[model samples]
Target: MGDPIKKIELKDGTTRYRFVIDIGRDPATGKRRQLTKTYDTKKEARAEYAKVKHQTDEGMFVGPDKTTVSAWLDTWLKSTTVDVEKATAANYADALLPVRERLGGKRLQDVTEEDVDELVSWMLTSGRKRGGKVGSGLSVRSVQLTLGRFRSSLNVAMRRRLVVRNVAQYTQIPREARRKAAAMAALRVPWSETEVRQFLASIRGHRLHAPVLLALIGMRPAEVCGLRWSAVDLDAGTLSVELTRTLVEGEVEEKGPKSEKGKRKLPLPKPLHAALRAFKARQATEAIRAGELYERSGFVLVDELGVAWKTDRFRRAIHKLMEQAKVRKVRPYDARHACLTYLATSGVPDVIVSAWAGHADLSFTKRVYIHPNVEHLRQAADQLDELLG
Candidate 1:
């Protein structure tokens, strides 16, 4: 007969049966080895033992591993080839830090949905220490991103058969939390046309005027930063958006646009076109002055020394221009919102606006970009009244 099953009471007052089976001898040492398995009942133990014995007989059995969640996550991060961007990969690594700190020690097979829920809760309320001060809790979007990273990592683990299932997928943010996130998103109001004009006017002769104007013309900051002289056609009044500049792991890299929509050519607004012509003349003068010291990068936006502008430096310049213009400060990227709002309210067709803004879907352009001001709404109401009367 096989080894008799022994019953033991767990800390939770549940009895479980355990049994040992002689799997085989270690080929290297030529010594016999055994594996122990536990089950809730003698019948379950006997069934599992038979399955193990059958697998062993067929040379298909793999011994149990003590791999933990941290070990598996490390493996996944190093081995994954899922088309992730470099900056996005860095973000995933950062998101995994809290997850590893909380659940890293748990065995991969023992991770539960409740553990994921706890991680979400902690992310919602926890603060990070910076410059000897602890900031407020992470925003809902940030927490969601972190959880998304965890789910992606766990999916890899599941594929590798490290875990039976992705327990992180079972966790969800509460309704109240989602509502708060929505409310936060709703607070981002687009700048009015007058404010936009004032901002452009204030930065007229600024070194960064061209990039700032390009951003107002609906280019993302990265797109504007990546703009090349080769892509510009002043005579044709158009520029092609074929590449984007991004800061990845503290290094600037040039890559193609995020999507096909991002690769389209757009007509340059008259003011921006004139600005670019003037900027080109100014750059030519500088190039001549610097002589051998000049670095000819051919980027549309650059510093006084003719180096390409970094995103952070451009953001600071925007803030400074906002202060000089006496306009409410907004994120530099909000220039897109201003442009989109103007286009939407100007009675441009949704399809055309979507194309100009490089949005894959018109619905996204309508929902996210359109911000109808009171004046536009009043005019619309007046038109409706006239038709009704």
Candidate 2:
């Protein structure tokens, strides 16, 4: 605290009020920090000074900031959030790259709604990178996720009184962008039942057949990679979902399931049970044959060396196998969608299907995971044909 207000004569002989207050020392550099304000009249300066005093008294005052968006994001990811997991923080750091590139240099308090609005437009147009291409527009979904995380980060800023409001709030994706997203989604069609059967036939008796089959049975790739031999009981014909191993920029990181429901026990189908038994025996034979080289990592998805498979490798392997089999190449996630769609179309109960997919919300499981092709809707079309006749 210092003098609340001081009247000073300007060069033009007019008067103004000024005040300076010691905020605190910068924790990073151990340098002193202060805030100085000049006002057109004593009354205004006194009012603002009182507000500052009240804030200080209430333990809500924030020091003057030289913090830019990038710096704040770095610090926030590292130190601000106590509950955020390392992988999630890594994702947040990644999602905010466009923000850092566009607005990182601006003072944290200086960013306005207009600036954020421009950022939204830029991200949806030519600000994103895709598939080795530079300056390609991001999908509308990607833009929405990036901005959603940005808005959450800005909420923390607001709580600290760094800004009076969230400058990044209330952003909406344009209709044109939404239409483009729909078109892109349509082009990424998942495999139909025939394609699924072809893929299964192609991967039959392969060393990684069991793990690949898990994906076709609605297991997330992370779940498949994370599975260990201990979680599977061939005698009981059950496989438990316990942990997940995911890739963070090419590094394998072990973590728990996404939710409580994600940790489930699924009864193995006869074919999958046989596949696992054969794979387990093969792995044992290889381990014994190459005793010194065997790592014995205990993971279900591993190479001959016993090292656990990460998602990227698994995804690529699946794609290669699809090409070799002459089957349409769809993402492993899309395979999970096809499986869920199959269950839904084949009269599986909605709750049971959701549980099998390790999802808490039945509607979400159906809406996001179930993808039906024209063949799947033939029954409805047939019924309509009869009705019209």
Per-residue lDDT of 349 in model 2:
96
Runs in model 2 deviating more than 4 A are 1-7, 11-64, 78-80, 129-131, 384-389
What's the residue-level lDDT of 61 in candidate 2? 78
TM-score of 2: 0.85
Instruction: For each candidate, give its TM-score against the true structure.
Output: 0.83, 0.85
Deviation in Å, model 1, residue 209 alpha carbon: 2.1
lDDT tens string, model 2, 292-354? 999989999999878888998999999999999998778888888888899999989999999
- The global C-alpha lDDT for each of the candidates, from Candidate 1 onward, is 0.83, 0.86
Worst 10 residues of 2 by lDDT: 75-84
Compared with the true structure, what per-residue lDDT tens digits does model 1 show for residues 193-222?
988888877888876677788999889999
* Model 1 bad stretches (over 4 Å): 1-35, 38-44, 47-64, 129-135, 387-389
Which residue pairs come into collision in candidate 1? none
Candidate 1, residue 47: lDDT: 90
lDDT of 1 at 228: 95
Which candidate comes out best when scored by lDDT? 2
Candidate number achieving the greatest TM-score relative to the actual structure: 2
